[model samples]
Target: MSPIELNKRQDTILQIVKENGPITGEQIAERLNLTRATLRPDLAILTMAGFLDARPRVGYFYSGKKTMTTASESMMNLKVGDFQSLPVVVAENMTVYDAIVQLFLEDVGTLFVVDEKSHLQGVLSRKDLLRTSIGTQELTKIPVHIIMSRMPNIVYCKKSDSLIGAAKKLIDRQVDSLPVVNETENGLEIVGRLTKTSVTKAFISLAETHDL
Candidate 1:
């Protein structure tokens, strides 16, 4: 799973909790000279992400679960094939309006643009559609290929890739997902999609296995 990037204050909050926990929210807030209300969101996020645990009256405490180094090593062992979802694809010539409809119907954040042979040609994202929609151009008149991000610009992965490596690409590229492809004589064939949700599921699976 992608690590949650904590802000300075959030990092400070975690340190305080680590050193003096089962500490109360109020006490934590006091140390930082902030209101309890102000610290509530950060505490909630840390707790939900499994960094901390809370008791009704006992307040908050670090979970002291597996260290980051150990968890990262386990995550590196995960393969993209194990966690990817089926690719949601659209024909390159498909109208932007139709692509938008297909996107919502499929409940996907991205649509892979493909040729007649199902070879990847480009990628269409929610941001792309939104940008098109707000323009004066008629959506139906425009083809997805016009606005889609085409290769050699696409970031992709193979089924054999490590999940951690693919996850890093997703982060560095700042894209919602990557097409999991298979190389063929013709081109790259879209076999699956590696997404943040997939990474999160992998992390949850890893956590469960550790507990077991």
Candidate 2:
């Protein structure tokens, strides 16, 4: 069945399974305020779609095999512009302490370091801040640019890249997030970011509907 044809209830069931795997039909019904009888059709359809699995006594669980395959397929189906978060950037001249404050305020793990023109310059992570903090040097005197991962070596995603592709990069590179860049006359400009947490959450959402 087309993804569009899946009703909201079915979608919710799949998501729940994805999030709380090895869940039971009764548990799903309780969460949705529906009866097991009413939810059977959805469970059946999701199982048929390779999105769910049924254990003898445990109830239902999401089939990881299906989740991975479906997530990959979904990623391939995305337009580059769809999965980006608006750029949250720090100026290169900003102090490490300033960047730390930004990181805390934004509740993000990384920050894009940008030049005066907003061109991609570097990337700063929480680790960098913590490591620097251990030294006797004053944070206020340390420039963020000095500690950031320099350009060219940075792994970035385009606004048009699929979420799966971005997630793969994050996993393979062992990075927390990727900056989304826009091609500019001078060079790539920082446009946004895609975090591993966000990608994982998306996958969990996708699995919530299945009974398994």
Candidate 3:
């Protein structure tokens, strides 16, 4: 079935799953102001499109594994420019101590190291700082660039890419976060970061719908 054929209601059902999956048909109906019987066809189409899953006891759920495929297809149907996030970044010249402090204060596991021009230079993790600090290195004088994982090795995702794609990369690399880059006219620039924690939260949010 062509995605273009999906009606507004079907799209809405898919979105509801994307944002809140592992939900029951009754729950979805309530959110859309419809009865369960009215939503059956919509749910059927979404499940056929690989956007949703229905289980005996669970009722219905957004396919976490299939979210990437559905998201990529849905991008063509939705406004591409609608979703964007401004990335938080740090300078390459920042001290290790400062990076550590910032990581704690911001409650983030990774930090992006950027040049003065706001170009992505590298990435630093808590492990990197701790490893360096164990050697009796002076944290205040050391630049983050000296220890950061340099480019060509940096695993990143474009903002245009779906969250599922980014999450897959993070899982495959066994990393905690991914830098979101913008493919500008000049080069790739860091715009945001997506972390495992955020992905977990999204999943939890989706699952919570069933509890209610």
Q: Give a tens-digit lDDT track for model 1, residues 104-161.
A: 9999999999999889999998999999999847998899999999988999999989
Q: If both were scored by lDDT, which would come out higher, candidate 1 or candidate 2?
A: 1
Tens digits of per-residue lDDT for model 3, 1-212: 33234556766887887788778999999999997756654564465456677797777777743443443343233211112233557898998889989888887788888888888889898889899889656999998899999879899887556556677888998888888788778667886667777567444433332122
**Model 2 agreement with the true structure over 30-92: per-residue lDDT tens digits:** 999997756654575466456777888998897753443353454355433444555689999
Q: How far off is residue 37 in model 1, in Å?
A: 44
- The alpha-carbon RMSD values of the candidates against the true structure, listed in the order shown, are 13.2, 11.6, 11.4
Question: What local distance difference test score does each model get?
Answer: 0.83, 0.75, 0.70
Tell me the TM-score of each prediction against the true structure.
Answer: 0.66, 0.64, 0.59
- Clash number by candidate, in order: 0, 21, 2
Order of candidates by TM-score, top first? 1, 2, 3
Looking at candidate 2, what is the lDDT of residue 66? Answer: 40
Best by TM-score: 1
Candidate 3 residue-wise lDDT at 61: 77
